[model samples]
Target: MDFTPAIKLLNSCNTVLILSHHNPDADAYGSSLGLALALRGVGKEVVVANQSGKVGRFSFIPGFAEVVDKIAVNNPELIVFCDCGELRRVGERFEQEIKTIKCSTINIDHHATNDLFGSVNLVDEHASSTCEIVYNLLRDAKIDIGKEVATALFSGISGDTGSFQYSSTTEAAFRVATELVAFGADAYFVACNLWASRSLAALKLEADVISNLKSHCGGRLVEGLITEEMYNKHGVDSSEADFIVGRLRDIKGVEVAVLFRKEDDIWRVNLRSKSTALDVSAVAAKFGGGGHKAAAAFRSKMELESFHDQVIRELMDLFEG
Candidate 1:
């Protein structure tokens, strides 16, 4: 889709507020900082913020230090939201400001569940990641994407596409990679930090989660649950648990993989499908959640056992249907 409206809107703004999703991932930082730095290059007063705070792994990206833990804006002429499927995905703190945003709001994302909340909504579900969309916007705006710009974009692509291992990796994504490299993106740094730099705590979390893995549907599905006890034992927190689903998805003979984390009174659910026989996003939507076909997620209010049973039943239906 043409990103002219977003380009024009961006060019028209003087001071802009840029925000990314909660629990920010590679794509979140990639798109947010890539756009934020580029806007600053054009002399725009830019505020790049993520409610989850800056992730250490992504600190290699330029402008990562500037990503605020919270956004503070009184009356921005433009508010640019990147990579979030819904406003709530950006964290609950933004709810009041988002409602009263008298300025033009721009929503640019790749999530299938995006609600088109922006005055200029640029949602391309088929794109490999929102970073891809942001890349195009930068190109259209004729921004000079130097080394840092390329690095931020590449980090996002690598993050969301599972370092080019996920099904979301597309030919276009690779093409964009080539262009970013030409613009001086550091691929080796991305690999070393984003993938190879896992802490001891993360390794323990992975080992513990795998030891407790469960399987069902005759091995077509596998799951792992991380409770506060497990996190405490591993000397990690929910942030380190992000890799659990990837581990489960690697098991042989598994078509669907899930990872659940008990956080307070709710369970955070993550889903992945290796086969086309299921649309996991539909499964997530059944519980007011949304994502892509191969990957999706939702939250559960039921007790751990109850939510486990409920999700397993849905997985069975997805297979049978």
Candidate 2:
């Protein structure tokens, strides 16, 4: 796709506020920080901010120390949103605040559902990850991507593509990975930190999720529940249980996996589909959430039993239709 417009916008801006989705994963951080570092290298002042703040597991990536939880809109010439399908994905507070900001905005994402809510939208739904789009943008801008920048971008691609194990992993994804590696991206470092660095508490939490797993529709749909008590018992947060949904989807004959994680008075529902034909994002969108075709999530305030039945009915309809 043509990135000249985005490149020009970045070149013209002096100060930029970079944001990613709340509860950011590697791809979100990767795209945000990677672009921040690259823009800074070109003498642009950049602030990387996320409502969820810096994730401890991703601290190994360069520039993690610089991430701020609160956005200081402070007259930034430009705002760049990374890996967020919609503006609200940044957080309720940010969404309201950003909509009032008069500055130019850039929306860079890989989700098909992106609303193109930017003065410059650099969205490519076919891209493996937002990091992939950012990588291309940097290359098109003729910006030299150093080791740190490459590693950050590589982490995003690896993450969103499930370390090149997901259906989104394309030849272009592998080609980008190869190029990033050549640019000094440390593949082993990203792998070790993102995949192999889970703590013991996280393992216990995963086991609990498995033990609580419920199969419906004759094993075609699997659901797991993680209560606040379970998180307290394992001393791990919701992020630690992020992998459970994928594991649930991996179960043989399971077409859909749902993870309902209790967060205070509400439950965060994470959905995953094993096949493209079963677009889980459609389900998430019904609950005011949006994401990629295979993975999506939303929050629910309904009683657990009621919500469970509702979701089962929804998925069963999808299955039957």
Candidate 3:
């Protein structure tokens, strides 16, 4: 849908408040802050907030340090949501507060599952990243691209497109990226900081995960497991294992890569597919999670061995189908 009307609505509204999902990722935080920066550029009063202040490693973008902890919904005229598709991701604590707001609400996202919950929605599943959409929206509104806005938008583009390595990377994504770079985004420095920086504990976890990698289905599938012991031994949190699954997916002939980690009382499964025809979201949805075709995740209370068997069976069916 065209965002011209949404742009007009934003211009008319005052006291704009922007929010993203809980445990905000690069796309979530980047897009929200990028939009907020653009809104502020046009003499608008904007406040950006999230459910949690625990920033991820990717929060090094220019405007990222600006995300506030508390929500200041003092007679706000507009509440905008970015990169959050489902209400569950917003958490129940903030749900009541957000719904209680007496203002026009807008939901701008790129997820397929979005229900258009807001009075105005700019959901486009074909868009490579929410940042791409935000860039176009700001451009449509004739808003100047400042350095802070450019940096935040570039972070979301690079992150959601897997540094322009995923299949979803489109020509428009590159175009927006180039424009953002021209607007003073430090692409090289941001890339280095995001892809290069790693803690000693994270390095150890990666090493252990690599050592434990297993090949299956005649080298067509690769799987790795990171147990609670691994975390304890490395003195690291579960998020330190984030990069392991992507590394597994980079294997030469592997069509599918799976990473399993213990989360609380269940196993959290992250699946990635190198081939285009494989929709990993199907597998994730079967359990209780959902995502895109190439990347998806799910969680189950089943033991590791049982979960492995169930996943293997589902993937085998996918391959055979």
Instruction: Using TM-score, give the best candidate's number.
Output: 2
- Scored by CA lDDT, what does every candidate get? 0.86, 0.90, 0.82
- Tens-place lDDT per residue, model 1, 90-175, is 87777665777788889999998899988889899988999999888889889899889899999999988889988888899999
- Each model's TM-score, in the order given? 0.96, 0.97, 0.91
Clashing pairs in 3: none
Worst lDDT 10-window in candidate 3: 84-93
Candidate 3, residue 238: Cα displacement in angstroms equals 3.4
Of 1 and 3, the candidate ahead on lDDT is 1
lDDT of 1 at 18: 95
What is the number of residue pairs that collide in model 1? 0
Error of 1 at 6 (Å): 1.2
1 or 2: which has the higher TM-score?
Answer: 2
Say what the RMSD of model 2 is.
1.1
